[model samples]
Target chain A: MTDTTEAFRLVVVSAGVSDPSSTRMLADRLTSRVVAAAKERGRETTVTVVDLRELLPELPTALSSQLLGPRFQRAVDALSEADGVIAAAPVYKAGASGLFTSFFQVLDNDLLIGRPVALAATAGTARHALVVDEEMRSLFAYLRALPVPTSLFASTEDWADDALNGRLDRAAHELVLLMESGFARAVRNESWKRYQHTFGSDAGRELGIDTDTDLMRLAAGGSLVDSEDPFDPRTA
Target chain B: MQFGIMSVSDITRDPVSGYTPSEAERIDAIVKIAKHAEEVGLDVFAIGEHHNPPFFSSSPTTLLAHIAAITERLILTTSTTLITTNDPVRLAEEYAMLQHLSKGRMDLMLGRGNTAPVYPWFGQDIRQGLHLALENYNLLHRLWREDVVDWEGKFRTSLQGFTSTPRPLDDVPPFVWHGSIRTPEIAEQAAYYGNGYFANNIFWPKEHYRRLIDYYRKRFEHYGHGTGKQAIVGLGGQAFIAKSSQEAHAQFRPYFDEAPVYGNGPAMEDFEEMTPLSVGSPQEVIDKTLTFREAFGDYQRQLFLMDHAGLPLKTVLEQLDLLGEHVVPVLRKELEAKRDPEAPANPPSHADLVKAKYGDDEPRQPRPNANRGDNVTGGSPYQDSEAEVSAYPTL
Candidate 1:
């Protein structure tokens, strides 16, 4: 912002269950460092948390019918306006929690186009450390979100490792640069039409109708052909 | 606004009785349901088209024509005629023949069928459904309006001066309603032609339908049809009514729990909360139906899904009695009282269309010219028709 007082929105979606879970703690560390990095660049930042545990009751209806309950709508609303997103999830088996993947899967594919995201995960052992980069990053990539290169995966031992702090700082620096540059906002404002979107998409803040499409012309009873084929096999 | 009933023609096992009606029995029962709807004072009867088993209406015109013979005033229509799979030429001819048989007591709603496999069965790819719907309807529009159609499109075989007969009754085509859940292109097509737009708001929440309906109304005005409120609109509602709220719930619980599409998913109560499903006494149905007008404004038609989920003939008839006697009468008066005086009274019926096309004059009864062994390519196809300059160049 020109005044340097407006806060860049940072939404943290953590699927950690327990009160003081490591997954959220990992996301929190990333969020704080991002805020600090942005502040160093003379930009303000504000963070909003989306706890997937609170969204448990709404998941069944959403998974079955694609009906967004109130809590899910709020999450979509926050993410739509987010300048950057820190998505953290717990590794249950060899994969990310279904809750985390489902929350992203059900979102309108255009909702996070070009959005800066920091992917992180927590598990009991370092054996499942690749969950963030290998699995969760693919999900955000499908949504067209821009994930920072360094994925944060903290196991029980990595929580105490000083190297975890270095990786978090690098991700934060990359996210702050992406947000400060306004890459997501600029792409959305300038080239949103290039993306595929449906009418009632969650990213339906734009109700702009392009009357220039061939479909619109056809809707107005215009023909799809520019010139009739010289050879009519039906007649000849 | 006009009120009616629509059926998916589902053949489900009666969750209470553990019995499923045979295909012949279900087909015959559908005709009886249409007659009873008319007997009870409902204004319209529409049936869906399904190409699969357990849903019997593959030929809607055949069924609607039969219903039209038994009932005098009940408007015969389709909840949705597949616009994507069926050739627009056949649609134009068959629907025209039905219109003449029913003597202008019919109209049809068009949709891209949801069953994906059914698309391939008809030699069409579901991936091209939207384009098929838009392109096919464009050809169909001309088939009914022009005496001879010289057309070509990507999806279907090209036509060289093809005549879809017997040219629409009184030279006026049957009114069309484009039914869609979320496609704005379908709504735009409906608006461009000033046709009625119908949304089945029974399964999902009203908010989803509201956006598309609002878009239709806005584009309806943009296309120079009329004011947004004056644009013809239709909605779908579902209900199971009885003498009291508890009895309504008790009777419908088994069907709601075992029915396809919605069963084993959201609880009936949650569905009722989010959608246009009303399960209660007559007053409760009326009250819930009233809120639809509040959400979507004064519109033309309301059709309820009454005879599905294997409620049996006897119970469905009883539900219709409550609906016709108890629910619809109150809804009619309340919606009428609340409707803007300038809004349309009902969707354009055949007579309304004839009057609009030829006001205060005799409607043209098209007569084929005596062309020697030629159908459509001879100068003009009808005694009173002009040869189109270039049907494929009309943009």
Candidate 2:
């Protein structure tokens, strides 16, 4: 284990469309609170805010081509390399914004697996606040990201409500605790092989081609002729 | 290194002229393009295989046989012969017949083609694509190498005492190249068989293929084929060229912007920088191509995709002229200069394969024995076989 002096890198992905959207406001509040909480816990913190609006023009191209444009790649790289991620998306049609989902969709499927993610959502009415719990939580769960227990939802009225700050503080502290605990690094270091696809893994075995098979041996330039019995038993 | 061109056989309407060539015209133009490839001093001319509309290469051997009759020296090959859906026994027989027709002036690249729906059309499931590719190639490999094949696998029906006709020209099967864009398993497969690995290095970044090629090289050595540096590797590139860079970009932009595969995706400059696409002067093409050796190490073949995106045949021919006269000659020299002496100078040709197999002796000319009523009653079907003559001889 290393000392607590290392700076914890946090990335905030804000999927607000407008210049001063409340979704971004909620993101900024969450990021600052997380940073402050980390500092209180005697850990230094650095934050990168990825504004998804700037990536809109390239998203379709990225999705269609399965290749990321440079700008979008840089934003994705920042998130991928960060120690923790704060994802905040505005709710539209009772779900997280398409732009937000689209951004994550274009990422490599295994990229966010085992990373710590904090989910937040903003909607016009309190009725859609469950978008965080129902939509965002499931999204991160599918990605295999460990979402902190406390999810933040800010509605039109929640902005002025004092309880919003309390919820933000709780969620931010949980994320900071996850970061300081080094759960992400532990999972990445200890059991990463368990998560990856490799030559003899279950996926490779499922394909019916493993390393020791005759197909593999032949591929390795081994002769198929000189074996003790050339006929397959199944055929016999 | 062997420098050449490949076509996906897409029939798109010319974005600028708004005219689409008829199937007859496009097919004729493709043959003209192939002959022009040989005339321009290019060594290889490869055509793709597609079973659906918008692509016209369903019968590659038919088209290639015609191309073979017209040209003497051009090495004919498929940019990719579909291995997933096509029956391996048929692939073995058809390509063997092609080898005889071309007089061993041919080889093939195998790929599990990208289209999903084409699978069921051939009575196969798309979910088993990789398995089908693996099992089919395994059967195809044995079909060409062995005199008689008794095989069973998941996807295809059992083959008992099957002999793929024509028995490969001079008993040397056509050299194979496994072409893949993303699958490391394909590279592993290539390495395992000591066959060539071809990275269709278009539409993606060099870094993407670098990892794949690197894995192949390492596995090639791991399988004891050769040192990693000596692995036979081929790469696909895309280029449009002219005397001046401005003219090249100006002429190719309309086609590039409207191309069905990559159109409306990235800016021209960004795409060029990201992929192996060079859209400028012949000198720019030469310089960009030379960098591939540095990126992926000295490779065996460099094939460019030059005919798609509905560029007029006249312009495509001109592009070939520039490629043959300018870009390829310089690339050939520069790549050879940097190549390691121990590394393969070119991919194995018909002559090389024959020599490797026979070693100064006369190669086998297989004569089938008279067919018995039941194939199982036969000891062996060929005249050269040491098995007892239980079946009547052809004479």
Candidate 3:
């Protein structure tokens, strides 16, 4: 599939806190290869990295009062504009780190519907290898995001393995194809009204106001009585 | 440019003193606060209605009526009166009675009380809140404007020939303001009926409310209320003032840290930056408040959140002294000078309403034919009605 547009927007969300953290490395690997894969298909791409560490200070206020601080607002704007996404989180205990899960959780539902996301996770041991598929995939699924089938996992041992690079290539190729498929663009452009969106949700993008509804009819000083079942106060 | 105080009616503990005002004490103190607001030359005093604890103002009309009797010229109102849970018929009756009792010194701001449990307490579902708010206001709007309303809607039972009584002061219904933070439907509804739109510009960022306000203004003009710039608008913000910026911060910090709903969450500075909360000197408050006019445009009312978070009555009164003595007077002159001549200088009072309905003529005084047992009259209840025949043939 080929897009007539000049460049695809690819966003990477990384929950890795420290410099050169494995979680971030896994996301970067996907990011670089996705750019390469898009080039192979003759498509240019622009990448934006949303470091969860930079979002940490704003998360509390966002959760508490639904007020997006500058950082969260920027992240939401970036995520909403992405043509494809790469979400990479570190494993803490058995689940994704709270920072990673929280960043996704705070986003309004339907914000990412139909967008292709490539999932990746890193942990200290091989026991954490299943975190991407078993844990992180479900979260993306709940967000209505389409996760590429080749979920990337990197334990310390797997990082040096050639198989890890193979999964990255496959995922990157899959993401580029999904982006070219124009499914997410179609959903946003065509079928967006079919979804139930709260006013001001989706980073304030869902603003279509239909004045023909019953509620709107009533709001405009119209009577609530329908002709089919008109209420006759005199009869009652 | 009407200046006032709008409280959540919170009974929060003094984080610094470790004492919570009893409901009785807080309720008693609220009247004093409203009276003091008038004494300090503030123009209006509004309270909220809440069924849950930590909030004492369950019945706002009662409180406002009492304040109306004791004070003169200070407009009494609610930060919001729940239009969703309470029967709008009852709202029409009660606020109309308050309107008459206060001698046209009162008004209404309606909200869809979305506190989930409170909805069920009134036999309503929170999910249907917007529908209820819309349909109920559709009915409430008529209840005030029309002598009798025959209506049926999804949420409430059908009403036939129902006349909410006392019939409004001077045949003029109290003005209504539709309050919302984010809901476009609420804004649209306000525009649809040409009602005043009140944005509780306290928590969210200024741009957030700014966008909604602009939308409301555009829709208001679309609905033929007025030009976009002349549409009636009100703002509810939070502010704390002292003579010096340092004193203001030092006095308000503990209250901010432990305030209900947002305490222990974001730092005060961050909240102030994100929201329109002004905490500083009177000049600082005026400077911050002046920006609201720039952002929201020429508008009618500006109400502040000053009494919540359990600041003792003494401190609250003192804050009022500073606000009255130093703040609102200057705000009045500055905002007055900047106000567009075409935009309304104040929200419609009962006198303005009476005049609108009947200019230089006597207002309609409803003389009831008879009660007809439970207000179900065969024809129009008032002498002014010229139906000439009953919709139902009399027995």
Give the Å error, residue B78, model 3.
Answer: 0.7
Clashing pairs in 3: none
Number of the predicted model whose DockQ against the real structure is largest:
3
Question: What are the per-residue Cα lDDT tens digits for candidate 1 across B1-395?
Answer: 89999999899999999999999999889999999999999999999999998899999999999989888999999999999999999999999999999999999999998788998898887877887899899999999998767888776788986888888999999999999988878989999999999999877667777888998999999989999999999999899998999999999999998788778776778778778899999999999999988999888999999999989999988988989999888989888888899899899889999999999899998787665465553666677777553144456
Q: How many backbone clashes does candidate 1 have?
A: 0
lDDT of 3 at A56: 90
Residue range B52-147, candidate 3, lDDT tens digits: 997888999988988999998999999899999999899999999999999999888999876899988998878778777887888888898888
What fraction of the correct interface contacts does each predicted structure contain? Answer: 0.53, 0.24, 0.63
Q: Which of candidates 1 and 2 reaches a greater DockQ?
A: 1
TM-score of chain A of 3: 0.89
Candidate 2 positional error at B247, Å: 1.6
Cα lDDT of model 1 by residue, A1-236, tens digit: 22346789999999998998888889899999999999998888988999999998878777777777889889999999999999999999999999899888878878899999999999999899888888898888888899988898988999789999999999999998888778888887788788887765645565666778777787778766662433222332
Cα-based TM-score, every candidate:
0.93, 0.92, 0.95
TM-score of 1: 0.93
Q: Score candidate 3 by DockQ.
A: 0.47
> Candidate 2 lDDT, tens digit per residue, B83-201?
99999999999999999999999999999987899988998767667666777888889899997788866667788878788799998889999998666668888988889999988
lDDT of 1 at B133: 91
